[model samples]
Target: MSRRPVHSVRSVTAAAAALAAVGALTAAATPASAHAPVHPRAARHVLLLSVDGLHQADLAWYIARHPHSALARLAGGGVEYTHARTTNPSDSFPGMVGQLTGGDPGTTGVYYDDTYSSALLPAGTTKCAGVKPGAEVDLTEDLDKNQDSLDAGQGLSGLPGSILQMTGNPTTLLDPAKLPVDPKTCRPVYPHSYLRVNTVFEVARTAGLRTAWSDKHAAYDILNGPSGKGIQDLFTPEINSKAVGYAAGADWTKDNAGTEQYDGYKVRAVLNEIDGYDHSRTHKVGTPAVFGMNFQSVSTAQKLPASDGLTGGYQAKGVPGPLLAKNLDFVDQQVGALLTELRTRHLADSTTVILSAKHGQSPTDPTALNRIDDGPLLDGLNAAWKAAHPGAGDLVAHAVDDDAMLIWLTDRSQAAADFAKAYLLARSGTGNGIDGKARPFTASGLQTLYAGTAAARYFHARPGDDRVPDLVGVTQYGVVYTGGKGKIAEHGGAHADDLDVPLVVSGAAAPHGVRVDSPVRTTQIAPTILRLLGLDPRSLDAVRIEHTRTLPAR
Candidate 1:
């Protein structure tokens, strides 16, 4: 069924890779050459799937052991980028944005799914930033994830663990007054408006190609872009709501398998769209030129705590163990189902399948879990800021952390002072500070580390752009800022464990299961999709700026 000629790079020596790079650079000079529309019998569609939190090592090990798994089956005739990595701050928001926009957070204006934005809340809104109407705060999925009680308001379908133990009065983040604001435009931001870059969907739609996508939350509407155009059919059922109160539905109640049920519904949604109909959308249909969905099943297992006969979370390095293995199998089944649908419709040869993930989970070594309390840190920063500006009403607006902490400060100009005060108190104190009294903070050389490397590439922003974080605290490996007792493993860091995501591109004009070791970024997926759809990759502004190139094509 393969139509593209094969080119292998599995054993590419350094010299060979260098030559390929030069070739790629030379070829990329004229990206517009690929704009010819597909012939009548040519592949006209691209299927992109992101299994959130699925690490490359996890996939490699899974494929090797479960030779018959869906990933292995696809790898048989696909181009596997073993060295594919996501952009820094590899949270779902920035990672997915990077894939579809060919830009990092610095370029796309997206930092995390839940981040502080200085833009005014959406029009016709009155709440957010506490009493300060124009302040920056979180506008994440959790805001609208769960509100109504399930089964006649008699359920608990939100927030992991018993919502009873939440600190800082988190319910306030979801309050109508604490809405998210887009700093760039100073408009109250919705999901789509939050995205600062054009997505492949918008590009494809502008070029007259149909597109469809499915993700866990409306926050993913960022993939649709600020204009919110391009997507012919979009399905977002709200996973947090579906998994509210951890209700184990009949379909997927095996340990962490409940997430599979949520993912399964979306997979079915994509399949239905691919079959030329979207009951949720209009009737103008055929297979989309670009279609995809993200699965959170494995992510559920990756964050699962070990308790009550549960051996979940990252088991060893390569071994997914029983819990994760089940989710992996479920993902495989969904992919196989998608493939079967394509074949039955005689569209297999007319479609390109790209199997990948948004980001990888970190702290695979469970023994080194370092849970830090963020309360003291936030309080210290707030005190410092308040002391500097008297009655500033908490200069630290909000703080989000995975293994790394992304803190949003109210006064951007005083960032240095804020950092200095917090650092001094943290260093002199004990407790969580070191002595356990919730010391000011840890001396992780956050500024030093952030400055020593690709700081400009990741943190560079325009002047007066409140979108940039005021202070960033990247905790040491395995050190999460929250002392929360739910998830054992988290992501959002520059660590190899979090950046290394699995990427497999197959079908249509793709090579036959060739292994590519040359370093590639998740950003390549956008340009690659444009190329696959017979569009000039250069048409994308971010791609043009980055001089991005598609993977090898013969």
Candidate 2:
């Protein structure tokens, strides 16, 4: 859908005034009053915790099995959305963006980890390569100037210059200057690039709230990368302090090696930040209001070979499944430790803790599993179709996730769409292609899926959008796209298993042990947080589903 033009402040004010005159508006548009002191000693902090790949069932099972689990305890003290779910075609990048921006793929325009679009460039650029290239330097200055410039041309079409250039280009490697230097090695370390969003930390900082984050993935660490321009003062593990990791070739498979060890060590860093009592001197009291952390060891464990078994030779009857469960328990222990630290610091009651997964993993269909031995069926189809339609330029066919494939033909000529449709149709079956769910649709079907209903709007008529997939092939449940060797499980599809995730909020202000069963999207998290903080939720596009009147009034 075409983005509604950003209205000028003058125009917005005038419209609001007109609406007020007709009694169509109230104080809703005005900024909420500063939160009044509930008790003389109420807590005013927020802690958002992210459990990588933690599924809804996982939490429910954990809580059911172990009533003393940190999550269960939190739920007893607050609320848990039993029926919480994410948006369609769920993936890590889009899910996180949905939470942070309070917008879905249609609004945020971030569909996958790698959403390629040739329209990101000017008219002269030929190739639709990955992220634009540049040094991973701070763009705060440029962004500030761009915001000002856009404010002047509030009604202009297209994004502002800074956002256009930033989004259009691929991300550059992290700058050595911004990274921490290792005293022993005298060099920088860590995977220091690959984030593309202005996250919550930045927003809190601009609002004069002190913020800290601890995360596991490269995307989370690279908050100050191109995506995290406005953030200031983030405390993390010393190992991730560098722009790259130590060159000793740390093995990821070893039980206590590589990132696993690093992650364990990193928890202390977050603990230090949380435990620091003299917030006035260290994080600045009253401003030290937001803190978040991510635990990714469980996600890493999922990636290990199924045959490896659990750590310390604890080989149960099952293969990776046993190991996965054990690892989840370990992660739960870590969370428990963090909660303990919060209580020790007297921050648990005041803090609003949000526990969720970036995305969920689908177990490999035990019935059909293999490894990468031959070309994927989609690849073969693309090759044959390309040959048939010689006029179609270098076609872009990408497998975004285990059950989804997106194809973008360079040439929008007549032959391209016809060839793709025929090729896709020919390969529809359980093993032949996308497990009989590969129904080829015209652009109209694509629009319908995106817009939800005929009344929905359509966007993406921009220059750099030519790279959007012309046809998307979806797989049914228990079906995943694989090479010669198939995977037992995968994600990145429209299936319910991959899209649904837990949404639990716990704290002093929340309702105790309440389970909400309404279907809610991940996009609602940001707006929900803003609402809890007594901020204007209108800026976001998310639909507020739950009635939050039970929350302590501001």
**What is the total number of backbone clashes in candidate 1?**
25
Give TM-scores for every candidate, taking all chains together and pairing residue i with residue i. Answer: 0.80, 0.66
The most accurate candidate by lDDT is 1
RMSD to true structure for each model, in Å: 7.7, 13.1
**Tens digit of per-residue lDDT, candidate 1, span 1-554:** 00123233544343133223113221144444234442122348999999988988988888888898778978777777777888778788888888898887777878877766554554335433443434444445555434331111223345333222222112222334335554344445556666766788887887788788887554455677878675766665555553543444521222465577667767766777678866233453777888888888787787776422556766565567567776678788899999988889898887889888888887676654556656766677667666876666776665677777676655555545355445533442322321123333346323233321123234666544656665555556665555656566778876777788988877886657577766677888887787666566676767876676666532
In model 1, the Cα lDDT at residue 476 comes to 61
On the 0 to 100 scale, the lDDT of residue 175 in model 1 is 36
Q: Please report how far candidate 1 places residue 145 from its true position, in Å.
A: 8.6
Candidate 1 vs. true structure, TM-score? 0.80
Best by TM-score: 1
